[model samples]
Target: MKPQAHPTLILWVLASLLMLAGCASPSLEDYRNRQPVLVPDQFFTGELSARGVVKDFSGEVIRTFDADISASWTDEGVGTLDEVFRFDDGEVQTRTWTLTPVAEGYRAEAGDVVEPGLMQWQGNAIHMNYVLRVPYGDGTLDVRMDDWMYLVTPDTLINETTMSKWGIDVGEIVLVIQKK
Candidate 1:
């Protein structure tokens, strides 16, 4: 039998790499100078809930989560992460944080439930990079997530998460929020 060639598979691999490369954000200062999202200081206040399902590479539903989050803004343009509760994996995890705004966006240090991470604002989006402490003999793992917040209205924001776990590219989570 002759050798078979698969151009489609090669094309798909190339396309995936291109998509990943597209996420390389420019410098924070210059990027922010252009068409910024211009979020208000008090944007994170009030009660918010996001519901979504997580899918794998094969487009299979892996897990579902409902995240309840609350925030308070301060005079220093600080977005204080008041609380976060996630219901998923047949378990509920609650996390509390204190956020301080740096040059770009905010840095949240979690007291419980989740590990601490840095969140930066780019235009209409917020990016999250953190280390996940997986429960295993394996050590901690690093993750980079781009969380984009799109405002459907003044009180509604949709959230999307595209992240890599342990330096390996996973899938993403898209959640729509409703304020309470």
Candidate 2:
């Protein structure tokens, strides 16, 4: 006969595993010493172009798009990014983002955003979180977006965004933007 493990012991193990998972997430401070620091006010200005793909939860590419962005900044430090996207399926979408400088980062707002997003940057990377409304079956669905951007060169940046619903990842987008 074999001895059985106690129920309390099992619960404790599961709890410890969850805590470790949460602590494993990367923080902005981790990249503080990276090179080619990213400054939104400088990199996001002028004409830019992007090419990217959207992947579903299964990691299958569902759509591809090319976008043209026109970015400008005001004397007061307010920034505007106008984007027009053309998809392979002939769908066209437009979004405009207004970024206001804050003490530590920037407050970002867009037409399809459910609420304003907070953007923070350290070293060469920037991170932002927000809820975006996307067209669904008949109406729309609000999905949380976790966006990360890294400046690799003075004129090039890589962007990655994860879309989640109810704490579950639903899709992702990977793109590269280059100044024109």
Candidate 3:
């Protein structure tokens, strides 16, 4: 014969487990007042080299690429970053980003972006939110992208992006960039 647990005790244990499971990492707000505040155009200038990988939902690497990037700031308070990417599978792509300062934070515009993206800076990180149109099978898939960049050193930056479609997480991108 086995002893049985009370219903109230079972419910309490389950509730505690659920609460623990729902706990998540710190949000951008948590770093709002931290030190080493990030500045948009200041940290992204000059020539940089990037290596990145794209992973699928299962965390399997699907593609890898390297990019030659050049960032410059205009007198009009606009920053431009030109990136030329060469995929390991022999594909080449170019993307130009125009970043302009706004009242709240900054606005990012790119050819593949659905509209202007909103960027927020905190501590040594910059968070970007946007929707990107990805070409696939003669059509396009609109994916919501939450991009984050962390400055590790004077010339080293790390980036991570989460991609989602229809509110379902699809994949992620991890990249390391070094200034030249």
Off by over 4 Å in 1: 1-40, 84-89, 111-118, 134-142
lDDT leader: 2
User: Which stretches of model 3 miss by more than 4 angstroms?
Assistant: 1-25, 33-36
Tens-digit per-residue lDDT, 28-49, candidate 3: 7877775566677877798999
lDDT of each: 0.63, 0.95, 0.87
Residue 32 lDDT, candidate 3, scale 0-100: 75
Query: Which residue pairs of candidate 2 clash?
Result: none
Better of 2 and 3 by lDDT: 2
Instruction: Rank the candidate models, highest lDDT first.
Output: 2, 3, 1
* lDDT of each residue in 1-180, candidate 1, tens digit only: 998769998899988987788677544454454343636354567677778877665667787888887867767766665545464767666666667777755676765325566766655545566544333256543455555665556666677766566455676777877767
- Model 1 TM-score relative to the real fold: 0.65
TM-score for each model: 0.65, 0.90, 0.83
